[model samples]
Target: MNTTANHTSPPAPRVSKTRRRLPVLILAALLAAVPAHHALADKNDHIEARELLKRGEIVPLARILEVVQQRVPGDVIEVELEREDGLWEYKVKVLTPTGRVRKLYLDARNGVVLKIKDD
Candidate 1:
């Protein structure tokens, strides 16, 4: 009878609980920061818009709505202030008496109607 010894490699080192949780904790932190960053950005946008209005760079919504009403007699539904091609514009949507919606693009600085489209 021959005596043979079975040689097995030692088990790998066990990972600590903190080491396992490091990646998860980092991911959670990154996810939490995303919404906070967005909130700060939204607040900054409001501040910039207010500054523009105060500086007369962009006209007020009330004035823009008045101009829109004269051209399209409808219930004002929605309005959005957007910047395009380095120019500020007001995109206005109106629901007309004929049950049709019209989208109006206007120059935000002076409330000049730039284009109107039926929707």
Candidate 2:
């Protein structure tokens, strides 16, 4: 009988504990962050018009009265926007530049002077 050389198979490659756990941990973290991001985006997306009005975008009543006093050179006792008969208009009651109580109507769309009554 002839003696033959014995061949042995190589061992399987080893996987580190850290490498196996890291990917699963990272995937779990990413999934958790997704819903939190969506909730934040939804909360900030829309605002109401009434809420906007309170936040100083629309003209303030005090400032409008001040402008009337400066331009007309008299005390503006009252200012209001009212629907008159069937029309929407700004009704401004002022102690005029001439020291008379005057009522004026301004066109809402263009701010053009419409009518003036001094009393």
Candidate 3:
């Protein structure tokens, strides 16, 4: 007759409720924060644009386009306002007379070409 007792390792220590829930709580908080971040990014640009227009701090798009066209003599394809180095800038992408694409970075407050990049 077999008399040797079977050997089995003891079960692991049970985790406390808080310890088990900590990871879940952290994940939930992170998930909740993501949407807020996206919403703020989406809202800030439009809000700034509207405020600049309301306060006459930024020229109208038509004026910007006209100035850019005068300098580059091209078709304006895309325009965007961006903030860089605590300054507002307008970026314009144009297809020029020679069929070359150029990106023009303009000062948003006044129509000035900050940079021109070939694309």
Cα lDDT tens digits for candidate 2, 51-118: 32356333433344444555566555555444355543455676654677887766433445677777
Task: Give the winner by lDDT.
Answer: 1
Worst 10 residues of 3 by lDDT: 28-37
**What TM-scores do the predictions have?**
0.63, 0.40, 0.60
TM-score of model 1 vs. true structure: 0.63
Report residue 54 deviation for candidate 3 (angstroms). 1.4
Segments in model 1 whose C-alpha atoms lie over 4 Å from true places: 1-44
- Score each candidate by Cα lDDT: 0.70, 0.48, 0.65
Off by over 4 Å in 3: 1-47
For all predictions, the C-alpha RMSD in Å is 18.9, 28.8, 18.3
Candidate 2 yields a Cα-based lDDT of 0.48
Report the lDDT tens digits of candidate 1 across residue range 41-115.
343465566677889998876688789889998676666666777787877778888999999989989999999
Tens digit of per-residue lDDT, candidate 3, span 17-57:
55864554343222221222243344345555666767877
